[model samples]
Target: MSHSYHVYILASKRNGTLYIGVTNNLAARIFAHRNLRGSAFTKKYRVTRLVHIEPFNDVRDAIAREKALKKWNRG
Candidate 1:
């Protein structure tokens, strides 16, 4: 069986702070964020809302998308 890779976005609130990440286990990753165990940035800003998710067949694609999203300016 093949696995899925995902690019996800988490936010503090609508139009608030945002975080971009890539993971093979979307559910577990989101769960970690919700419980303040995702990362220092997420914990510091309370970015717990799962705002966006994109799945890819390859890990490289997901990682590339994640990098692109992170480069997108809020402006």
Candidate 2:
């Protein structure tokens, strides 16, 4: 089975940091983040925790959402 989702970024606290991503498996992805294996950015800034997530039905949609988030100012 193929699954897709538009993963989102979340700060450790209010405006503590920013993380942008997309994943087919939210649970696994979040677990990775919590363990410090999520990604280089998250690892660098220590942005671990499931603060935000949005599921999607299409990979394209997820990609688009990720791109949009990427363009946003982390401030």
Candidate 3:
């Protein structure tokens, strides 16, 4: 069976501190973030809400999208 890749954005609250990342398992990844185990930035900022998510059939596409989103100015 094939796996799914996801590009997701986590936030402390609406329009609050944001964390963007990619994961193969959305639920598990979000769970980790909620438990303060996802990443140092997310944990420190308390970015626990799964505000946005995008699925991709190719991991490369997910990664590229992730990079693009990360480069975007939060303005």
Candidate 4:
């Protein structure tokens, strides 16, 4: 199966630490963060709950969306 790219945000909790990332496999990526894998930032901040996600057919669009979310004020 072909996988689409996704821009996603993970939070430690509601209104807590936020992390923005782009991934081709959303489930596996989230799982890794949750399990405290190789992600230093996410693991250090304990940001594991999936809060937001935007799917993109193109890698450029996914990266752009991730960048946009990174600039958003945490709410």
Candidate 5:
């Protein structure tokens, strides 16, 4: 069996605060975020809306994509 990782983007609202993250368990991560247990930033900003998700075969690739997305998000 093979495993896939995900690079996901969450938004507070339409065009609102954005968050970039990587996870092997997308559903669980999103659940945690929505329940205020994933990240402090998400909990504070209410960034629980999933705007985008990308799948990768490797965790490293998922992390790299998350980092790149964050860089783009910053600027």
Candidate 6:
């Protein structure tokens, strides 16, 4: 069997606070975020909307991309 990974961004509102994360199941993760079970930061900031997603065949690649995105300037 093969596995796929996802890098996703969630936002509180359009152009609002952003949350970046990697997951194997995007739907479930998004559901959790919407239900206030995703993470401390995401729940606190209300970043529940699925604003963006990137698919990757390797988990390492997905993680790397997420790390790079997190390091980006928020300006």
CA lDDT of each candidate? 0.93, 0.79, 0.92, 0.86, 0.90, 0.93
lDDT of 2: 0.79
Check candidate 5 and list the clashing pairs: none
Q: Would you list the clashing residue pairs of candidate 2?
A: none
Q: After aligning candidate 3 to the native by TM-score, how far in Å is the CA of 74 from where it should be?
A: 2.8
Candidate 3 per-residue lDDT over residues 1-75, each given as its tens digit: 455999999999988998899999999999999999999999899999988999898999999999999999988
Candidate 4: deviation at residue 35, Å?
0.4
Question: Which tens-of-lDDT digit does each residue in 1-75 have in candidate 2?
Answer: 445675777566666877888888887888898888988878888888567777888989889988988887755
**What is the number of backbone collisions in each predicted candidate, taken in the order shown?**
0, 0, 0, 0, 0, 0
Model 4, residue pairs in steric clash? none
Q: What are the C-alpha RMSDs, in order, of all predicted structures?
A: 1.5, 2.5, 1.7, 1.9, 1.8, 1.8
lDDT value, residue 38 of candidate 4? 31
Models sorted by TM-score, best on top: 1, 6, 3, 5, 4, 2
Q: Give the TM-score of each candidate.
A: 0.93, 0.81, 0.91, 0.89, 0.90, 0.91
Off by over 4 Å in 4: 1-3
What value of lDDT does candidate 1 attain over all alpha carbons?
A: 0.93
Weakest lDDT window of 10 consecutive positions for candidate 2 = 1-10
Ten-residue segment with the worst summed lDDT in candidate 6? 1-10
Better of 2 and 3 by TM-score: 3
TM-score, predicted candidate 2 vs. hidden true structure: 0.81
Query: Residue 71 CA error for candidate 5 (Å)?
Result: 0.9
Candidate 1 residues 1-75, lDDT tens each? 455988999999989999999999999999999999999999999999998988899999888888988889889
Q: Give the per-residue lDDT of model 6 (tens digit) for 1-75.
A: 545789999999988999999999988999999999999999899999898999999999999999999999978
